[model samples]
Structures are given as C-alpha cells and as structure tokens.
Target: MKALTWQGINELAVKKVPDPHLQNTHDVILRVRRSVACGSDLHLLGGYIPAMEKGDVIGHEFIGDVVETGSGVQKLHVGDRVAVSSFMACGKCWYCKQELYSLCDNANTNPAITEALWGHAAGGCFGYSHAMGGNAGAHAEYIRVPYADGTAFVVPDSVADDRAVFASDAGPTGWMGADRGGVKEGDVVAVWGAGAVGQVAARASELLGASRVIIIDRFPERLALAGQFSEGVETLDYSQVDVDDALREMSGGRGPDVCIEAVGMEAHSEGVQNAYDQVKQQLRLQTDRTTAAREAIYSCRKGGSVFLLGVFGGVVDKFPLGAMMNKGLTVRGAQMHGPRYIPMLLERMARGELRTELFGTHVMPLADAPKGYELFKEKKDGCVRPVFVP
Candidate 1:
C-alpha cells in the first residue's frame, strides 16, 4: 500500500507502507475510495502543529468503503460505504450522551472528572498531528478506523464520492456553524473566506433559510463560486472593498445578522514558520489572510453571532476583543462533529436542499496530491474543493 507521508515542512512523498488491519473490537478496516487535503493538513505540513511526527499519515476528511469490521462493530459490515469522522470516540461516553461527542469523556477528559463520570482518557486521533490519538490516517490505501460502528457513517451509494467527501468534515462543519447561528428566513448572512469550509457555510446558511447571503473573499474565482451557491448572494471582494462598509451597506446600515468565519487559524497570525521552511520558497506570507477574521468580527451586527470554523493551534494577535465584547458578539469555534450531522445532511442532500455538488471543482486522483495541496494553499487552479479519488 502507498500513503502520502509527511517528511517535513512542505515535504510529502508517496511511500509504500504496510496496510492496516483490524486492531480493536471497536475498529474497522476501511478501503479508501476518496480523500482530500484539509487546511489542517497544511498546518501540520508547515510545522505549525507542534506534536507532528515525521511519517505520520496526515489527512482527516475522507470517504471510504468498509473492507472489514471488528467483532464489536455491528452497525457496519464489509463493503459498506462510509464517511469516517475526524475524531474517533466511544458512543457510551458522557459527552457523547449530550451530543458533545468531540469532548467525549471516555475519549480525552483531560482535567479529570472521575473515571466513572468521565471513563478512560483518550488513547490518540487518526491522521491528526501526534497529540490527538496518532491512529494512522485515511490518506492511505486503507485505514484502521477505531470506534468504527460508533462514528463511521454509511454514505448513500446514490451520491458521488466527491459530493459526499466533504460530509466527512467541511460539509458537517458548515452545517454545524449555520445551525449554531440559528439562521432563519430573511437573516442576512455573511461568510468570510470562500474556501471549502466557507463555501459549505454559505450553502448551509441558504439551507437554513437565510434570505440574502453575502460571501466575502479576496479571490475573484472563489467569490464567483460563492455567488453561484448562494441565492443572489452579493460578493464582497474584501481585497477591493471595505468589508465593514460593504456589509453595512448591504444590511441597510446594520451589519450582517449572522457572520461565519471559515478562515480558521489563518484568522490569527501568519502561523509563524521557521526559517527552515521551503514552503516559503513558493509561498510568501500574505498578511491579509490574517485580516479576514477580524473583518468577520467588524462586519458582524451588534448582538449577532460569529461562528468560526477554521483550524487553529497557536496564539494570534490583533483580534478586536473589545469591539466583540462591546457589541455583545457571540463567537464559537468547533471541529464538525460529523457523526451527528451526516445522517441528516444525507437526507437533505437526497432531497436536494443542500447543493454540495456545486462546490466541488476538482476530482483528481490521490497521486496528484502535491499539486492539489499546492493549489489549495495558493487558491490556484480554480480550487474550490479538490477530492482525491483512488
């Protein structure tokens, strides 16, 4: 089997590796049908994630077919199509009971809430940097997925792999943010960044009944795509226009009722890179990548909610905390608890309420991952969301 291994900053190579097998009773062996590069993978590649180890399989969102399942995995069987969750968690945990599966007690209740109340601490993560349970990754030909029946969701066979791919991460993350924002009919929504996550956020807002969606992105290409997914959505090229002014003008002197920040950790600082970075050879730090987050805060209406859906690991500066507090802005950040949303999102997609297919611009093979990662990092090649089909 071959998997893209992270050798160092901006260094990735396809190397022959041993295939994974069922390791735990709660585990499943998934054959990779499709996978894609996530922005978080860039963080790990750039050495921004401290605990990342060389040779760690680094990808989180992917849709796969179940090749085998452990004895305890009854919900899924071999040959079932499934979307793997970003995090593996036991279903019987205390937090899982509350729908806060990301903070599952038996998984990683670090602060100590009593073993009976919390259960066992987390053992590790799949494809995420070392700190999260370094449990291999799905970027390979096959992945050994733990907490299989508890989190692995069977994606509908009717949907194309590329369309269902984002369901593993961005699709559900977007839905979670829109749901958290409580988008209602006639709500003026603004999504900052036209990245995959941002695109999904805009589409999710539409599904949630936002009347006039406005998507802001500096990239004309992405903004154009954003306009297409959102119903008559006004596009703000923040590079050319003042975000606060444009958002205010569109909202009749008020700011957007709901603002979704999909630009994540890039919202903070330029993710300080070491001098040894070769990514710097092809990429120079564009400071505005850091501005859109604060811009999301600035363009938000008073008393409105700002939902952040980007990846983060380090400290950042220049956020308008005083303004957020003064205007009573509610801000929340999350990784999509996909297991909670996949079933419902599937139903919506089945009914055509969620138009995920429009957002997929590229469906290349897994072998072109370097090009995919480069373009995704540069927002080149009309890259909306690139899926790697193996």
Candidate 2:
C-alpha cells in the first residue's frame, strides 16, 4: 500500500507501506475512498504538534468501504460504505455515555505520553501523532478502524462521497464549534478563519438560528466563498481594517454574542503582538500564535461565550486573562466528538439542508498528495481544500 508519510519538518512523501490488518476483536479494515487535508494537518506539517516520528502516516478526515471486519463487529460487514470518525471511542465508557466521545478513557494506546503532557489521555485519533495514539492515518489505500461498531457510521446512498467524506472530521468539528458556542435565536456570531471549519461554523450558526453571522479572514476568495455559501453571513477582511473596531462598529457598539476561533496555533496577523509571537515561536519558547485568540476574546460581547475549535499544542505567551475576567466571558473548547454529531450532519446532508460539496475545490489522486498539500498550505489558485481519492 502507498501512503503519505511524514519525513521531517515541512516534508511529506508518498511511499509504500504495509497494509493494515484487523488487530482487535472489534476492529475492521477500511479501503479508503476519499480523504482530504485539514487545516489541522498544516499544524502537523509545520511541526507545531510534537511526538511525531519519521515515516508516520498522517491524515484523519476520510471515508471508505469496509473490506474486512472482526467477529465482534456485528453491525458492520464487508462491502458496507462507511465514514470513519477521526477519533476512536468505546461506546461503553463513562465519558462515551455522556456523549463526550473525544474524552473516552479507553482509546489512546499511548496514554503515558499524553498523561505527561495533558495530565490524562483523551482518545485515539487516526494519523494525528504519536501522542494522540499513533494510529495509522487515512491518507493511504486502507486503514484499520478499532471499535468499528461505535466509530464507523454507514453512509447513506443519498449522500455523495464528496459530502460524506467531511462528516469524518471537518463538518463535525464545525458543528461542535457552533453547538458549544451556544448559538441561539437572533444571536450575533463571529468566526475567525475562513477555512473549511470556519465556513461550516458560520453555516451551522445560521442553521442554529443565529440572526447574523460574521466570518473574518484576509483571503478574498475564502471570504467570498463564505458570503456566497452561508445565508445571512457577512465577511470581514481583517487586513483592511482593525478587526476589533470593525466588529464593534458592525454590531452597533456591542460586540458579537459569540466568537469562534477557527484559526489555530499558526494564525498570522500584522502588528507588534504577531511579531512577538513569531519571535517566541522561532526560539522554541512558545508553540502557538495567539493573535486570533486575543481578537476573539477582546471582540466578544460582555458576558458572551467564546468557543475555540482551533488546535493549540502548547502554552501561549501573554494571553489576556484580564479581558476574560473583567468582561465576564465564558470560554469553552473541545476536540470534536464525531460519533455525537456525524449522524445528525449526515441526515442534514441527505436532506439537502447542509451544503458541504462546495468545499471540495481541488480533487487529486493519491500520488499527487504532495502537490495537493503544497497548494493547500500556500493557498494557491484559490484552493480551499484539496481532496485525494485513493
């Protein structure tokens, strides 16, 4: 099997690797159909997340067909079309019972590494890093899926492969962002970043009854896509104007009711704080850039909620705890619980209520994955997301 392997910082290669086999009684092997690069993958490529090693396969968002299943997998069988969740969970666990699948106690195979860094292990994710379970990623011909009954959702015939592929990660992550942000009827919501997650977050906000949704970014193409795809949604170019002032003025002196930070550790901005963060990051003193996070906190309405869907690996320097304390802001964040939202998102997609197909701006074969990553990372040719068909 040929898979995309991480060689070093900013280095990726397609090479032959051993095919995966069922290792657990509840496991199944999936012949990957469609897999896409995620914004979070950029963090991995940039060496923001640690514990990755040479030759580690790296991808999480994908859909496939079940080729083989263990004896314990009764619900799924060979030839079943499925979308594997990015994270694995045991449905019987305590956290899983609460529908917090990402925090499941029984998934992470490398618990010691995570417990050292995060005080406890959350869940095993496919092809993220060694710290996240070291599971082989889906940017390959096939992958082994554990807890298949709980993690792999059967795709309906009505939903196309292009749309169903996102249910694995991006769609659910964005849905979780809006759901956790506490979007309500007539609430004003603002989302930072115009990537797939940000676009879906804005759309989800509208579906959840937010009267006005604002998306912030520096790219004209992404902002235009957000404006065209999401109804009642507006776009803001942060490079042209002061984001805080523009948001405040747009809201008539009151900040947005909810602010979502979809841009993660690698956020870019122009100013002193960005320069400071860049210096610290280059020196290995800190692993995150907090420009978007700071703006999100400062621009949120008093007593409003700020949701973080972006991936932050390490401690940040000079976070505004004062703003959070003085303004009475509610801060919430989580890794997406795919099992909890994938079904609902699939139903919405099947009913034509959600439009995710527009996100697939570039499609390429598995061998062209290196070129795809280059295009996506550089944002060349208005590329939003590049999907690879294996």
Clash numbers, per candidate: 5, 0
TM-scores for all predictions? 0.88, 0.98
Best candidate (score: lDDT) = 2
Off by over 4 Å in 1: 108-125, 267-290
Could you say which candidate leads in TM-score? 2
For candidate 2, the clash count comes to: 0
What is the Cα-based lDDT of residue 186 in candidate 2? 91
Query: Residue by residue across 1-390, what tens digits does model 1's lDDT show?
Result: 888788888888777778898777988888898887777777777666655678877788888988888899889999999887776668886767767666665543232322333244332346876566566777788888888876788887677776777777777888888887778888999988787778878888877788888887777888877766666667877657767888898898989999988876554322343222223322543212335567778788999988877765534445689989999999887666767888887777667666677666777777777777788777787777667776
Taken over the whole model, the C-alpha lDDT of each candidate is 0.74, 0.92
Model 2 misses residue 97 by how many Å? 0.9
Q: For candidate 1, what is the TM-score?
A: 0.88
Error of 1 at 364 (Å): 2.5
Residue 97's C-alpha lDDT in candidate 2? Answer: 98
